[model samples]
Target: MTTVTSADGTEIAYDSAGIGPALVLVDGAMCYRAAGPMRPLAALLTSAFTVLTYDRRGRGESGDTQPYAAEREVEDLQAVMRAAGGRAALYAMSSGGALALATAAADPGVTGLVLYEPPFLGGDKEYTARLGELLAAGRRGDAVELFMTTVGVPAPVIAGMRGGPGWSTLEAIAPTLAYDDTLLGDGRVPGELPVSVPMLVVSGTASPAAMQQAAQATAAAFPTAEHRSLAGQTHDVQPDALAPIMIDFLLG
Candidate 1:
């Protein structure tokens, strides 16, 4: 594991493997370097590029300070890019995709970007309203539940997931959910995040239409971006299914 201190003095932890251009993976809410869906993705990416996956501040082995802001998260990515020898390809999922897009707009060192299913609602209002209420009320579990429910997962599935591996992992890092919600802004307006680098916006066929539309919106916003659909895949698309698409996009 390697470490770099962000401008705010928070120590960020990252691991690097493989050889070639550096690729930094930014995980979504409740995910760290060791938890959530990125773990398997990291292993697969290591075979192609020098993969750098880090624990976001306040999660895993990373250090955190009081009074968090989205800017600090952007700086964390900048710190990792610096640790990667100044430039890197970035792959961000969910709200992490939003963060990476925001960072790329400001940081020239991000040479390329790949975003998968950033959870913004282009047409849904009620869903986001419920999520905002849960977040404002400090109902972390309910916030997650609302998100999952809005994404079209059946109520039974959502209930079952509460104690499952994914839910357990999320529960452990619940503090970041509020941060994710903040970035999403109640899923009403897509923030102006621009990218000059070659970019790909990927979405799953099984995901909600709003999510797919958000991915489309992101692709439209980028000067040089393309959209790809992973047929029959959901938000939980496994790393194995995703690795080849990412490799082709990044290496092509």
Candidate 2:
């Protein structure tokens, strides 16, 4: 593990493997460097590119300086890039994809991006307000459960998960769920993204129709963007299935 100081002086912890061009992985909601699908995917991509997976602020080993803002998270990513020799390619999943896209648009030096199913298409205003209310009231478990339901998790499945092994981790980071909600911000992709930087938006074929549409919309929004659908894949896409596609976009 390694650490870098963000512009705000927060310590961001990360693990890097392999050699060659730097590729940083940004995880989505409820995930950090050590706790998400990125670990397995990073293990596979390490052969072709130096891959860095880090804990976003307020998660895992990373430190959070008070009062959150979405832009601060972008600076957190910039901090990782400086740690990786000043620039790096980014591959982000779920709401992390939204952050990566926003970063790539704002930071021209980011090089490229692989954004997989950002979940940035539709969200109700009133429900979102309720989510914020829940989080601010410190109803972390309810907040987490609300997010799960908002994302279409079946009630029974959510119930099952609550009693299972991963539930605890999910609850622990419940407060950060609001962070993701802020990034989503009404769930609509902007009409335009800064030109010149290359981007690839990917969605799994088996994911909801809206997910694939969001990926396509993302590609359409960027002047230099491509879209792909992984066959037989879902939001929880397997590492073996996703690593090669990311390699093609990030390394090729």
Candidate 3:
């Protein structure tokens, strides 16, 4: 484990492994180095590139400064890239892909990007307002529930998840769910981002049709983007199925 200081002076904790080009793994909502699929995916990619996995601010071992903004998260990623010899490619998951695009746009040091199913389908104004209302009222559990349901979790399944093993952790970082929401910003894919880095946008065939459409829309935003769909995968994509595709786009 290592640490980098963001422009806002927040301490970002990260781990680096394997060797070759610097490749940073960005997590989606409610995930960090310890509690996500990135670790296994990183383990596989390490054979081809140096992999950096980190706790986004307010999650895991990282600090969350007040008045969180998208730019702050961008600086956080830049800080990690600098720590990786001043340049890196990004492999971002879900909303993390939005942050990665923002970072790559700001810093030319980004060599490439591989984004898996960034949820840019559309926005629900009511959900956004309700999420803010829930969080501001300190209803963290409800906030998590709102997010889960908004993302298509079955109501009964979410009810079962409430007291499960990882439910508390999800609630603990529930505020960061708003942070992810801020990145998506009404969910319609932002077509104005000026990222020209080589890019690959992937979606799982078994995932919702909206997710696949979002992936395609996201790919269309970049001139150099390529869109691909993985068979037999869902939002919870298997690491082995993804790692090879990532390697091909990033190294090929």
**Which is the leading candidate under TM-score?**
3
Which pairs of residues collide in model 3? none
| TM-score to native of every candidate shown | 0.86, 0.95, 0.98
Compute the lDDT of residue 80 as modeled in candidate 2.
Answer: 90
lDDT of 2 by residue, 36-69 (tens): 8998898899889899999998899999898899
- The full ranking of all candidates by TM-score, starting with the best, is 3, 2, 1
Per-residue lDDT value at 208 in model 3:
91
Better of 1 and 2 by TM-score: 2
Please list the residue runs of candidate 1 whose C-alpha ends up more than 4 Å from where it truly belongs after superposition.
123-139, 158-169, 186-191
User: Could you tell me how far off, in angstroms, the CA of residue 191 lies in candidate 2 after the best superposition?
Assistant: 3.4
Worst 10 residues of 3 by lDDT: 185-194
Arrange candidates, best lDDT first: 3, 2, 1
Model 1 is weakest, by summed lDDT over 10 consecutive residues, at 185-194
Which pairs, if any, clash in model 1? Answer: none
In angstroms, the error of model 2 at 164 is 3.6
List the global CA lDDT of all models: 0.82, 0.86, 0.94
lDDT of 3 at 86: 88
1 or 3, greater by lDDT: 3
